[model samples]
Target chain A: MNIKKNFRVILPVGVLALAAVAWAGSPQILQPAGPGPSTASFTAINKVFTGDWQQYGQLFTSWQGGLFNRIFLLILTIVPVVFLLHYIIIGAKSFSHAGTPIKFFGILTRFLHWLAALSFSLLVITGLMVVFGKFIGGGPLVMSGRSVHLIAAIVFCLSAAGLFLIWLKDMLPMPHDILWLLIMGGYLSKKKKPVPAGKFNAGQKVWFWLATVGGGIMAWSGYTLYSFAAPVDQIRQMAILHNLLAAGLVAFFIIHLYMSLFAVKGAISSMLTGYKSREEVAIMHSRYKI
Target chain B: MARMKFLCDVERCIDCNGCVVACKEGNQVPVGINRRRVITIGEGKPGEKSISVACMHCSDAPCIAVCPVDAIYQREDGIVLVNKKTCIGCGYCFMACPFGAPQFPSGKVFGARGAMDKCTFCAGGPEKTFSDEEKQLYGQNRIAEGKVPLCAAMCATKALMAGDANVIADAYRKRVFARGSGANAWGWDRAYGKK
Candidate 1:
């Protein structure tokens, strides 16, 4: 064998000889004995209620109280600022010519929309007060906030149900919606290029779906949390889901507010007066059969 | 200043529930609520253990952190207490507590959850110490009187020890030394240490 190969073979034998000598002094490793009752035994016995699993509830609390609240506060602060900047830059879309106004939203549709809008606004306000009212007021504020929130939640759920039932068909995705989404719904384009859309654009459909689905989740989770009948783990899970969905819905609410008030010229009028100018509709929603 | 704590010797606890009864009697905790409970693990088994659990009054209490209305608070002496007047009965603290310490008086659905109740460590609440209202709403204020909690004082086997952390810890160390083993303070690592 070469010197390098001979050294490698000798090295393994030398190490093994040293290991055997070392192991001779201490033949076996034993677990240490400690004072008092072993927590391991207790934990193994009560594994379900008191173990590493309970820490998950603590983790959820940390996330909800620390990170989730901060995210909500950030959204509440930044969203308005962002929307205001966009409004300043773009302003509200306006038409130079006033075309014949066409009836778009019927009485029942507008009624349902406003009902949902009003109840949702109340829920948001009361919910915020409950979460953040300590900074502004005291115990009474929180108590009142919670009381009002309960009532508002009921109204919001009912109105959401009505809105979902009435507008489900119109809000479904169509083939042309893909093209509308591709061009950013013609909102960002400097050129007057109206994307083909029905009465509801792809963006509006997204808002509708989010509101309906997210609202459903909020209602169910809110009821579960409010009931206090579920097991502690399930209650905790529901609370986490409720906080997350509420935060997401708040974000969508801001976007919907911006789109209605500023992004589309006659969107608010269609909801309020049940009418949209024919020219405005033709430019904004080119595929609508007015 | 003393940082008060509770150390339960699981080896000595026999699950007699004397601590639970003593706590209930001392605090006059309402009919539907329990401030403390004794949980027996692996009953009739060889390594069976019993632990008397209440609020650990944790160093960083999740209850205080999660209370939306700022109802839950920790005293300078490290006992966690709740203001029943401020608690809204929203049950946020109930879900947040890792030990499931918080209890609501009513199980009625939709808005009838009374104020949240939990172990006060016999320290009472924001109400005047030893006041009738405090006694009614929050049980006893034995800590204010410089006495051990009713539950600890009433423990049959002396399993539940309560007082200043150093003093109780030293006593526990002595017991463990005398016995030469079985010194595990269950939940101590979780309540006070990262481990």
Candidate 2:
């Protein structure tokens, strides 16, 4: 009986010893292999910040060059074509008879408008060339485009600021804007509806906001990237934000160009000559007294 | 075809900065630009380790992806290179490189960045192989001469190895097996750490 009890005690002790050995020998806990807190050299900042920043770089390298670029190119081509077709199918709305022309845009307003428009158009062309010139053999074309883009960006920024200062009060959203937007700014109506508006219509207000706000962001981000003012990660973030804003600005530009040139007759003439025909104003902007 | 790569065995690196000097000397790299460097962690302390670092020539190089003018490209042998002729000095590649491999020479007085420069794996550039222009832009074309990179070849302790990926990997595997432990490749975790 004593021997049997001793045998039981020995078995339990042996099992415990074996288990201890196995646990001790198990592979180094397989710690996630990479730069730990002590080794990351890219950022003098914290590990979490650098890690998150690197993730943005990976995202941009993959999506910005691959999917985002392709989609933006497709949209860039299709949007202008679609707008052109839209104008051709439904011709511009024109007045039956020419009436007395009234002063619509002031001299300063007209100058600023043209300046902004000219700078914006140049920026778009040069920016597009910078982004897509490589596909078309980017030697002198891209080089020139970059130089032109820098100069145009400065003009665009100045004109955008000028427009914002002059037109902020005119472009504020009113309660009637909801109705104007609901009616699709009277562009879709079979019959021209007198959409009550102030100095600027809802559509024009939307364009103003996009141009001033979006343009400001683009200029700021572009400056930040060019200056290399921020850290590498921050610069990458700025690039991404700049590209996205550019795409949005391009879309708005297409619509604005079409609406001014074709959708509403005499809108371009008013922008050019600072006057709109009384009849045209009555039909297009009935709420605003001529 | 050999898929070329560099593997730095951190345990063997003595922080002597031998690789750094060798690369600069062999390439005649410009002042204030180091193609390779040795970074030591826990210096003058217990559990200290050092590793030599350079362009890893990544599989999907971010530099190539971000180049606006298609100035950067990777060779069939997986060496990342930049074409000086096409490079616009826009510095997009510099921001995109995860390893901070791209360097810009300080141009004028006001800290303007000149053309982008980096380790070319001793593979030269897009110019004619071993031509004068290639030598002027990129340093030496040691890879074309059927030789390994100078930095790794001249390593005093043989800490840095450069060759076909499979060959170096097998050699490193054998070393790890022989030691029965200590197989941690420093910076490997950082460059390609699993999420």
Each model's DockQ? 0.35, 0.24
Which residue pairs in candidate 1 have backbone atoms (N, alpha carbon, C) closer than 3 angstroms, thus clashing? A35-B183, A36-B182, A36-B183, A36-B184, A37-B182, A37-B183, A37-B184
Output the number of the DockQ-best candidate.
1
Flag regions of model 2 displaced more than 4 Å: A1-54, B30-32, B42-45, B105-115, B177-180, B187-195
Q: What clash pairs does model 2 have?
A: A33-B189, A34-B189, A34-B190
lDDT of 2 by residue, A1-290 (tens): 65765564467558857854553322212122244332332232213222543557777777666665775687689988887776777667876546668788889989988888998999988888767757766655566666677788889888889888888767766788898888877777547667777778898888898888778778877887677766666677778888888888888888888888878776798888888877776766777854
Candidate 1 lDDT, A1-290, residue by residue in tens: 46755574467558857854553322112122232246555555345444533645777778767777787899899998987886777667776447668888889888888888988888888877766755754455566667778887888788888887787767767889999889778776545666778888898888887788678768777887877656566677778888888888888898898888877666687789988887777877888885
Candidate 1: segments with Cα more than 4 A from true spot: A1-40, A52-55, A96-99, A189-192, B44-47, B107-109
Tell me the deviation in Å of residue A88 in model 1. Answer: 1.1
Candidate 2 chain B weakest ten by summed lDDT: B186-195
Question: What TM-score, to 2 decimals, does candidate 2 have?
Answer: 0.82
TM-score for candidate 1, residues paired by index: 0.85
Superpose all Cα atoms of candidate 1 onto the true structure and report the RMSD in Å to 1 decimal: 14.3
What is the lDDT, from 0 to 100, of the residue A142 in candidate 1?
67
Tens digits of per-residue lDDT for model 1 on B17-73? 999999988888889788898876666766677778888888887778887778888
